[model samples]
Target: MGPLQIKNILQTSPENQSVTVKGWVRTKRESKNAIFIALNDGSTIHNIQAVAEPGQFSAELLSTVTTGSCLKITGQLVESQGSGQAVEVKIDDILVYGTADPESFPLQPKKHSLEFLREIAHLRPRTNTFSAILRIRHALAFAVHQYFNDGGFFYLHTPVITASDAEGAGEMFRVTTLDLNKLPRTEEGAINFKEDFFGREANLTVSGQLEGELGAMALSKIYTFGPTFRAENSNTTRHLAEFWMIEPEMAFFELEDNMNLAEDFVKKVITYALIHCKDDLNFLQNRLAEEDKNKPQNERSIPLLEKLSFVVDNPFERLTYTEAIEILLKSKPHKEKKFQYPVGWGIDLSSEHERYLVEKHFKKPVILTNYPKEIKSFYMKLDEDGKTVRAMDVLFPGIGEIIGGSQREEDYDKLLGRVKEVGIDPENLWWYLETRKFGTAPHSGFGLGFERLVLFVTGMSNIRDVIPFPRYPKSAEF
Candidate 1:
């Protein structure tokens, strides 16, 4: 057998059975005549023990091996008496597969800051913290697919290189296939972008909502999970140049139906990760205990179980955007910090406002709905109130807005007028108008930032750490 997963070993109750396992050394402890190596494969967060007899393998030889060195050990399964683990192996054979020179390798048996770890992103997965993060990330991704698949949602793949800027924010990273040095120019000094591929300026998609709306008109229910790009140049913990987004669009659904779906979707994902990723979360717990001796005994290192059960079983706190603003402004907690941007009746909610509402005021995930027309997207339906558009933003405790959704404009005239009101040309959205013209239904959808969800699930502090290869402002370091 290849490298055996640590979880599978507990199932292997056959004591004294000889087995070969291959993994990297996490920690190695040596006595006068014996050595114990904690080995871990990518399979599980739990580390396995390999007890080496110094009579067979010298203590000097074992001590020479550094942390993160890959090795294969042939040993007999034995019950461990050590404080750290349950089952251990008495190693009869030890073979070094890959050697780690301790002098140059930055990773050692010590805690490194998150900043230092970012510099060594290539090898950070071998660390316990990152290993758990990656495992949670993988589990959450699987949960997202499973939730959609089990719910009878059609998985739709949309085009990446889109001719239209769906958000109309002009935040697209332009896609070009021409030599700029020998470029076509208009009568003016500016280059003619119309001569580019697709006969017009095309760029990467920022959101799959527009295309998803088209699919929903036909498919009735459709979901798209794909990579999106934003060239906003925002340097923040939550911002990324490129990130994943999951958009679910449903036809014949109102704003209430959309809010229900968003709530269920979030709950389902958290539940799935809790069930599937318990071991990884436990590993993180132990790491936390080791890192902070003063960690609360009652405070759960992994709140996945308790947190998710509450989510699935309970109802999300739903409040109108106006209600949330009132809570933020009236709260006794807001007395200390004066908000930089004036909190008014129509301005967009800042991250501070969002966090305060969800974390302090509600103490649960809050769905802030019916935002002002000036702050929301053009495609969102104008509410009966006239002042507000049908927009909903789901705010979690740690992250402000994980999801943004709205009921789309089914009326062609209204949509065209809204686009024009938003200072965008309706003529440019030629094919998009066809959906409203043909067969239109009351459709609703939401866009959840995939990296943000991953960060929330993995308990990762920075967006860069959640993604394998992060792209941010002025940086795409491999």
Candidate 2:
């Protein structure tokens, strides 16, 4: 009949007040006289302990209410019998609307493997770890919008389907309406895939950075937050077939300005999640620390709030890609790994190299700039060396490369030349080059791997765990 949140109840002014609460049973304990149930409502991180006497509600009635069963209860909020909690509910009435059987259901008291949990993605949120992850995910999302919005950046909705692959990763999943059995044939003998959809070979966008750049050119500042697809075959936890990206584009900005945006943006995200998701973070803290009560404090102090302050207050260490390579060559951590690529001045830094730079060398998030032209995308502005591009990847302590962005090749001839050099048809990027043709103002931006950011904020290791309904390789169900 009434709505009450466990958090609100716990903070009630009148301690012994009566309240009505509705939620699903998380865990239940049976006794000869009374039955205890921990009820979890999605509104809060905490669950209310409900004590219902078997004497009043028949044993059969109590039996019907199992873990995962939905219920509404009218109860007096009294102090808890256990030392762990301050208050609990003394149930006066109970309504068991829905029930779940322990035998047939998925969740149980025992710990389930991450692989097993991935199978039941939909129901994973009810678990503590997933709940914390999703909470941090949402908090970080809001933080991203707030960070951009506070700075007067316009929120732009970029197209999900585009004829152009923004990242030029060749990882796009094509969008086609043409029937496979009945293919359209042009004068050429090749299959006319261009006949599909909007009369061209369109596919899911790999990044919205290109479109975001256009918005920035007009609005000065703009950002896009949405799903982007990558059909890359690598099946690592760091790679996802479908993922979200936050790309903030700015006009009248160059490489240094772009790095400042990224540094501030990363801090804002961490700051917001730490502030807004305190309860959820603390949940992780307690869960992780409880495993080893004697564990060192430094290793366990990973919740966003405790560590984010230091990161936000400090300026990110900036090192050129060449400098980073030099440091990696001379670094002790790299000595142990015997890096697969083996460090070289002109070589692209591997994830391992980036980790050594951020995690061991700097011991914080770092920006490595001016990568070799050969390894970077075509859109990056050319550097003075005439060999390297203006591309940069923001490497965080735990998550190596969280962002990839660069100043656009604003020179009309340079862009066209780069397009030709990259062997992509210049026609596909005609409109992109048009921005440069029509008074472009040295715009720059970067794409933060939203899942990786979420992972960083929540101290979650796997990218798959951060995204709900994760679309990893051979994984589309649950």
Candidate 3:
């Protein structure tokens, strides 16, 4: 009786039963006897073919059925005579809801570069690549919640505005309502924050981990999935000014338990995409293959589907940061001077080094633990060795660090000392310090960059392509 989605129509048996379909026209092919239209409603990547006889509609009406036109059609579902698809619709009547002028429409039935699509992000979702990617992203996100919920983790909503910088990187976007042109000066001629909204310096949160810890301390297990901001000016393909992060904090968990949870979580989300988003994944796999054909044989990657399967089927290799450093120091890349960044005991691992470990050396997902305390965040629990902290980073083949977390320092004195050692004011974090002072338990958690996961799963080269509206340095255009 009512309009049915194109995806549902494509899946049903062709019984010549009349049905109503509403969607945007993807393409139109004109033949001597009829016009064949490909309609897609964004419910699925596949399109439904609708056949219209020459006498069924006027030339004026058919002329408007170009790409991007929205239409509602009443038709009888019948077996298609085509090779690729199984069913199609024989149109009885058509109504043109809206028409897109071919002369001005940017998305034609042709191949467009990813760079060009980035410029018109608002309309890129209609394209097959982006549509498929968005579907997979949705499936992965759903799986994240399902996995955590099944594991008895409560979803925690953390504040977007706060005075504390959890990462201590100082790359924060200041949130202020004070008039810059007005005078609010102190005796020392410093800008007085007493006139500000929060009555103190506030910033867009760089992470929700600190707040998540507060919830985990009471709830035992909690996770936060929310937008995070960073003021870093880097405009690399892997960087974003604003992005989503998945952070899960668990109480009474050690470094080893943390590592296990991270590995299982990643694998579960990937497996979900494989099962639920098979059609979209197949399209993306073919898309990546076609793109790879342009690259040199040595630079080209394996099939996208195979890469995903490898992650789902295989066990991630686990090792200590010390062992990983040893392996890298003695690696062929290091010995032959191929590494751009020097690798050693205290040096932080670069993207190149991380990729080498996962793609070439280990040839699997790697969980590297026990990082040097100086290179890691101050909140990370320091090991008995007094040198390394209980930090862990999960590295994938193409994407370096997909997840980073640590067992939080629970001892009040140790945490306070480390906070001061890192040049962060302990008094500013009095509330956080009180958590340790009152009833602190050993807790562990990790933050996974959601866009990076989508990028990796979709086989997309640029991080900008995965998110719908990308925010970056000097670029926030809708």
What overall lDDT, based on C-alpha atoms, would model 2 receive against the true structure? 0.82
lDDT of 2 at 299: 57
Task: Report the alpha-carbon TM-score of model 3 versus the true structure.
Answer: 0.98
In model 1, where do residues sit more than 4 Å from their true spots? 1-3, 58-64, 285-313, 334-337
TM-score for every candidate vs. truth? 0.92, 0.94, 0.98
Model 1 lowest lDDT segment of ten: 299-308
| Cα RMSD to the true fold for all candidates | 2.8, 2.6, 1.2
Best TM-score goes to which candidate? 3
Candidate lDDT scores, in order, read: 0.83, 0.82, 0.93
Highest-scoring model, lDDT:
3
Off by over 4 Å in 2: 288-310, 333-337
**lDDT digits (tens) for residues 1-478 of candidate 2:** 3476766777775477888888888889978877888988776688888887768788788887887888998889888887767888899999988988878879876687778898899888888788778877888888888888999999999999999987667888988899988889888877787677788888999988888888988999999999999998877878888999888888988999999888887887787777777888888766655544666765553544545565777778897888887898788766776777777787767788887776666877788888888898888999977888898888876567888989878888888888888888988888888998898678898888888877767766578888998997787886
Clashing pairs in 3: none
Name every residue pair that clashes in candidate 2.
none
Residue 256 in candidate 3, Cα distance off native in Å: 0.8
lDDT rank order: 3, 1, 2
User: Whose TM-score is higher: candidate 1's or candidate 3's?
Assistant: 3
lDDT of 1 by residue, 426-454 (tens): 77887888899998779999999988988
**If candidate 3 were superposed on the true structure by all CA atoms, what would the RMSD be?**
1.2
